[model samples]
Target: MFKVMTGKQAAELINDGDSVSINGFGSVSHPDEIDKAIEERFLDTGKPRDLTMIFASGQGHNKKGAYADRLGQEGLVKKVIGGHFALMPQIREMIARNKIQAYNLPQGVICHLFRACASNKPGILTKVGIHTFIDPRFGAGRLNEISKETWVELMELNGEEYLYYKTPRVNVAIVRGTTADPSGNITAEKESLIVDALHICQAAKANNGKVIVQVERLSTNPANPRQVIVPGVLVDAVVLAPDQKQTISEIYNPAYSGEIRMPHEQINRVIDEIREIDRRAGVAKERSYASMIIGRRAAQELRPGNVINLGVGLPEMVSIAAQERGTINDLIFTIEPGVIGGVPSVGGSFGASFNPDIIYSQASQFDFYDGGGLDIAYMGAMEVDQKGNVNVSRLGDKVIGVGGFVNITQSAKKVVYCFPFMGGGLDVKFDNGSLTIVREGRIEKFSKEVQQISFSGNYATKNQQPVLYVTERCVFSLTIGGLALIEIAPGIDLHRDILGKLPFQPIVSDQLKTMDMNCFTSP
Candidate 1:
């Protein structure tokens, strides 16, 4: 049987130098009250020090910052390991300053590592990070000097090469859920569906570690069998945190998705007001008006029966456009990590949400993604080479680590990469509703060779996958020779916008036409 305690009392179970694993994906399923309790404990007693934390999602507590951020601030954590830290800016900065040790791993690999521990396995072996930064021969997954450690090693089995991934024995496991029944069965239905709370608890138990679950409520009767995510056998302690907030989503509030169904006329009026201001400024630049132009263009792409997966950055704006166009109902939108038919949380909290229609654990979600279940996937690329191999993982000294980019891009049948024509310092303009290039960003996305090949052009070519590169100035499609320019933004010159910056010549199609005029028109 599991004992129930308040969040504060539950957190008291942890001790100094404990290797704790937290069950969360970005912000969803995070134990906020437990996190607060830990923070308060650190503030009052300052007992725990040199702790190592393993998390599945991006670091941070709530939207403000990551849990590691607070631990780093209090000098509590000695080292950290997990995938994605967009929500944990403070932790990233700490790594930059050499204040803490951090390792950014593939999201799926992290999930497997926990599962490996649960199964009493020594380590995990896979071909996922071959030829990438995670490969041991290539710097051994080092994000910073403090994080430089050889975690992955190349090994041969049955005359085939594989990467061996090792995970530390967990000392304690922290998880969050909707409720804990009297029998200790935990239901996390209202939170991320993708997480395997029972797996974490079982893994911790197998390692002789304690499992702490922070729940929103405690039920008297046995939870419905179908609703039980973690069985009673795996649970040790159930923490009743009534005041713990739910992860941000429609389950908490609809506004997080920014889907406000407004009248078409009202949307047009807003566009008109924006265009009038641009006209007064006497600049037809798209940079000054990209928000409106991109939003309008994305709205046009939203069609009924389209199962769309929106990428981060500018692609997120597509959801807003879809909502305004009254197509949000028609489309089933999903995020990378197994979240289906729901508005994805943005910024650092980039994982499954609490209000999704369906959720699968990160492992199962990746299985679907890697198996090519998605019809269309909109991704953001930092750079695209002539071969169409995308670079989204590493950029020079900075390593963001491929979270689910490889799986999604490789699996999606129709992959559309939305990016600016030029990065760094670029500008654009519109004349009589036609786009014009005014200034240019310094960075080149179309590079001679990408820093890392996260998405292999050879794979796409072999599979005959459809790939389209959508930019502010032009649209290109993958061809046998190279990227073939198919369309240009209205008023954009081929020589100035397309030919001038590329390190090599690109195939120009004679059938190329101007991008949609409505793309620049007021909504």
Candidate 2:
């Protein structure tokens, strides 16, 4: 009668061709011990072969501890339908070789679809990925040629475009938390971030499937009744890990779970960790003048007390610039992985924080995003086409599914596309407020057309949203006429360095002005 069991026992319940959903985002809040147990079970017996595994975002912060990657590498997962594969490069290599059937759906859509599965609803009909890749006319969330089955279909309703993601009953839900009682009530008091744990368990039970939760400790006195996220009635299995980590990188931190507010020294620890990473990677403490310039220019868009969201990559520099300017704490900062009101850790620590004010379920955060609570969102872009369309998900063969990018960009009042003018070895320098393009990158980011329309400028314009494309050498704004070159960096030639290098000509603003001199100097 005891629901408490070893991870191996939980893995034994999974069978071949079963659909399993694991809870995690940016590698935090996943049941890594249980996942490793499943991997070990597959390697020993290979009984749970060809399973359909689902997750919302990148499983791990980096290459290590990627639960999905371990399952895929062990040949346990037949197909993967999730948001990202950038962190799991080992499995991405498998995807490249067509070893598994993989479909990469947008993070928000998949997270929302889990809610539909939990309620036994028919399916999800949302205006998320309408025109680009998720549309049936395109690929319908199929990642590669190996992914032929379409789970998303484009449907029109009331003259609006919607991608209906067909929901499959989750046969098994595997999730993690900090503690559990004898009856298996869960509480995430020590987790780095509380992702979609509540929904993951519900989706599994809605299908009459077993809900197995992994927890760090067993509370003898029982978790506080009010803190019970997953009640006892819904849980079928509990795997305990006494030494569970708050994240792959850290052992534990109470500040991460929002249990207690930490002091200033503790909050700066994550920042120090980032600096150590930069030192190990040989990146200078100060970034390039180009990035600093772009970051400063983008920071200009921020207003105090604004609830701002920032996406990964160059836009991440906005936070760094904010910190350098000592204005990061002035406005509230939130990221998709559910951390709110903190200096969001960049790179490998994508989802966790040192001194987060509060953590909530990622679903709720996206709900706030979809409801237009975000004042602004700064995003990193791979390319900006002549029509002002931004591409951040597609490249050579990588289909980095829109991980909260679409949801944030489409809904935020103002969106800023932050990145350098070019990529692949482009270098710039600034001396005495004079900017110089030391080396031109072999690749041009501003092309005639983007490979994908991850962020539709036309859609933003239709919604009466303002967009700023902030780059190192110049700044652009999306106008009715298209991308208007509004500002150029000091000491840079508009004709030779900007216009001559652009694959597509932009609208020349009649009032073009030189970029602010302070952008090239220290904060």
Candidate 3:
């Protein structure tokens, strides 16, 4: 039998110097009530200090002082082993200031590590992080000076190199579900997305640790075994938060829970509602001409019946472009959170799909992705060098760790990197199917060398993967030598707009042609 406790009691169960694992994707499926209680306890009593916090993906409400960031007090988290830190500004600040030890790994690798911990495996041995920052030769996923431990090791397995990531022993798991019974049977029937809660629970139980689950309500009737995601045997305690939300933005949406298959038209309405919410929240919406041009060209790369993954930021416009071309149904869309064949929600509700065909654990989806299941992947790039190496994880001072970029890009048969030619206040105008640059951006995206390699060009080249670099101004293809300029937009001077802006010279294809005019005009 399992005990039912308040959020405060669950928070008290956590002790100092314990390794805690949290389950969530972006803002979805977070045990916010428990997280809040822990924060309150830490502030009031300063108990449960020096926790080693771990998460597979980002868990934030797209704003400060929400979600996992609530537990980011200086003394609360002594170390952080996370896959992504874009949303956790408070914790990231600690890492920047060298106040805490931080290790950044691939999101998929971390998800698989949780499974490895459940089975008492020594570590996860795979080639997912080869030649990237996660490799020992390339900084070994360390985010700060204090993160000196070698969690990742490069070993030779049967003449082939592999990255062995040691799994962390979890002492406590804070998970969330929709419903629970007195026996602690947990069901995620009402949650927006079931990320890695099951794996987290199993890992905790395997270590003889505590598993604290937050649910919307408690039920006397026994939960159906078919619907029980985490069995009672694995769960130790359940906390009831009657006012729990499905997502940060949504209270309850049957479409997100797969209870109802929303009509395609209604899916569009859901997207509109999210955009409206963003507008009201003062989020800066980027509806720019450069993104439109790049989105149209990126959408052209899609093939019928192809399984695709689109990264956040500029790559999100691909879905909108496909919608304009009436080909959204021809291709199957998948997100990193195991949501397949549905319209992916944006902004605060990113990880959840509006009407998904199926939802699996994040680990299962990565298994498919790591096995080369993705036909094509379009990802955003912060920097692209002449060697076609892309960097989306880090900039000068910020360490926006790679979430799923490395896993998808390295395993995909074909990869297309999408980003503007320049960043930071780039302005453009399209006049009657002709492109003109109104204002140049302060920063050039293409450079002599990228600061960090999130996706290795040499690995892609060695594997013979097709790669393309798409921008609003021109298109480049990966060649044996470097990037080759293959196409340029109309009404744009090649040397003045493209060549002059590039820091290093690129191979100009003799058969270079003009970009499709249809991309610039309205759909």
Task: Give me the candidate number with maximum lDDT.
Answer: 3
lDDT of 1 by residue, 1-523 (tens): 6788776777788888888887766556677667777877888888567778876656553334445455655477777786766556666666667877877667777777888888888888876666555667665656778676777889999997778989767778888788888888888645544464666777788888888888888888889999787888777778876765444322343322223334445544544454455445452233335544665564565558777787766676666667666677687777655667655554434564324666667677666666667778878889888888888866765545567665577677788887777777666778886787677777888888888777767657766988888787788888877788988887777887688878778788889877888677554
Q: Candidate 2, clashing residue pairs?
A: none
Candidate 2 clashes: the total is 0
Cα misplacement distance, residue 369 of candidate 2 (Å): 0.4
**What is the TM-score of each predicted model, taking all chains together?**
0.81, 0.95, 0.98
lDDT of 2: 0.80
Per-residue alpha-carbon lDDT of model 3 for 145-258, expressed as tens digits? Answer: 889988999999899999999999887999999888767889999987888899988888888899999999888899998988899888878998888888777888899899
Q: How would you order the candidates by lDDT, starting with the best?
A: 3, 2, 1
lDDT of 1 at 254: 30
Question: What lDDT would candidate 3 get against the real structure?
Answer: 0.89
The predicted structure with the larger TM-score, 1 or 2, is 2
The TM-score between candidate 1 and the true structure equals 0.81
In the range 202-254, model 2's lDDT, one tens digit per residue, is 99888888888899888887789877778878888899888877665567766
Error of 1 at 318 (Å): 3.3
